[model samples]
Target: MSRMKIALAGIGKIARDAHVPALMASDAFELVAAVTRHEPPEGARGFRSISEMKAALPDVAAVSICTPPRGRLQLIAEAFDAGLDVMIEKPPAATLSEARQFADMAARAGCVLFVTWHSRAAAAVEPAKEWLRGKEIKRVEVSWKEDIRIWHPGQSWIWEPGLGAFDAGINAFSVLTHILPGALTVEDAELRFPANKDAPIAADIRLAHAHAAPVLAAFDFDQRGPQTWTIDIETDGGRLALSDGASAMSVDGEPVRLDGGPEYHLLYRQFQALLEDRRSDADLRPFELVADCFLLGRRKLVAPFEDF
Candidate 1:
């Protein structure tokens, strides 16, 4: 089969670190162009906008949008208008209403739309899901914390209204929603906002399922030491833990061997499969949980997060 020509819509950190490399290595897709407001990556043909890219590279079949959530709705719409399939990064849009429109727009255009939750593609996620089946789960604890100075650096947009700690917390939510046995609803939440920023810097969220097992999550953007992205589950059988962003797992204190290259690689492979099947995978469970956290959370002012 011929490789599908695709354009990357944003050339930021994730684009450079993950998406571009994945596309270049994929057997099913080819990176033909880039659409960025800033200078594009070296050696790649650059375009000012999706419309311009479509006008120039008429043969580009799909676009992978790597832009921030606030501005992605319009970009996805433009791609659909140009009769192109789209694959967007996590935390799909600024609001649930806008994210909900992506599927409708894709359907109207007869194009494939994939709102990817890349963390769910992690090696341990599926294994943990399989291990938990038929077992009685007693509790779940998620600690997703990282230093903004390290991960985001000078990216001030992280403190924007729709992002912040949940930008990283949502990845844990995505993994939990994928592996858990049932649905979860936010029971209570405490959001710690920096005095100077519009978004929260740390949060404590409590969620519940019908089974009554408590789900506790702690998220922080100000950690100074080693980062943590761990989901520990206490089940009747034993303890199941996914650490290092679900790249590693252990059950009953024994390590589970994992096999995979990178999350983005798995994501593109799934996108290719979706395109082949003419299906759209826009799972909204994780996104909805984040929205609900904001809805039920009480705000507390913390020290001003003035730096990166």
Candidate 2:
């Protein structure tokens, strides 16, 4: 089988730490080129833009876009126009409208467009989904708290209005939407914007599902001791907990072990399979929930935050 030639856009932290390693380890993809305004590290095939990369590496069959959500539509549209399959990172696009536009364009072009939600590929996720299938869910709660200063460092785009902690929160919601049995809609929410920034530092969200269960999701970017990424549920079977952002699962307070590996690997494998099968994997339900919250929720101002 011929390996798919792949180009990476936006050689930032995620492109370096996850996508590069996953592509290197996979036999299905070849990392032929990269597009970034910043210089690529030593030995990396570099281009100032996607057009340059495609021109230089004509064999590139696909482009993986790791750019921020706010300015992704133009690049994605360009890639599709160049006749290459595209893979978009989590949250797909900055707004629901952009996501819909990309979906439509990809359909018209008849090219594969994958919107990756890496957390949904966690080892424990499938098992948790299976366990929840027949159970009666009474309530759902998701708490994702971490120190943005430690995780994001000097990155400034996250503080932009369309990005920030909600980005991570959307990832959690993606996994929740995947594992849960039914669709969900945000009922109410509180967005806490830092006094000095355009994006919110924390979000308190309420969701409703057709199962008649009320779901509450809380995301905080200011957590300090023992960083937490967990989801708990009260179901007829028992109390279920998914920690480490769905990397581990427990029921009735008993620990359930899980296999550990880089989640991006699974995502890339899935992407490869989708391309070969001539399928598109674009699910915007998670982002829709977040956008709905933003559209309907009340906002409050909080103390200014600094990256330190």
Predicted structure with the largest TM-score when compared to the true one: 1
Residue-wise C-alpha lDDT for candidate 1, range 73-102, written one tens digit per residue: 888889999999999998899999999999
Residue-pair clashes per candidate: 0, 0
lDDT of 2: 0.87
Q: After superposition, how far is residue 147 of candidate 1 from its true place, in Å?
A: 0.6
Candidate-wise lDDT, in order: 0.91, 0.87
- The pairs that clash in candidate 2 are none
**Model 1, stretches more than 4 Å misplaced?**
none
> Lowest summed lDDT over 10 consecutive residues: which window, candidate 1?
36-45
Cα lDDT for residue 84, candidate 1:
96
Candidate 1 clashes between residue pairs 3 or more apart in a chain or in different chains = none
Model 1 TM-score on a 0 to 1 scale: 0.98
Q: Tens digits of per-residue lDDT for model 2 on 33-110?
A: 888887664456888877777788888989999987788988988898888899998878878899999889999999
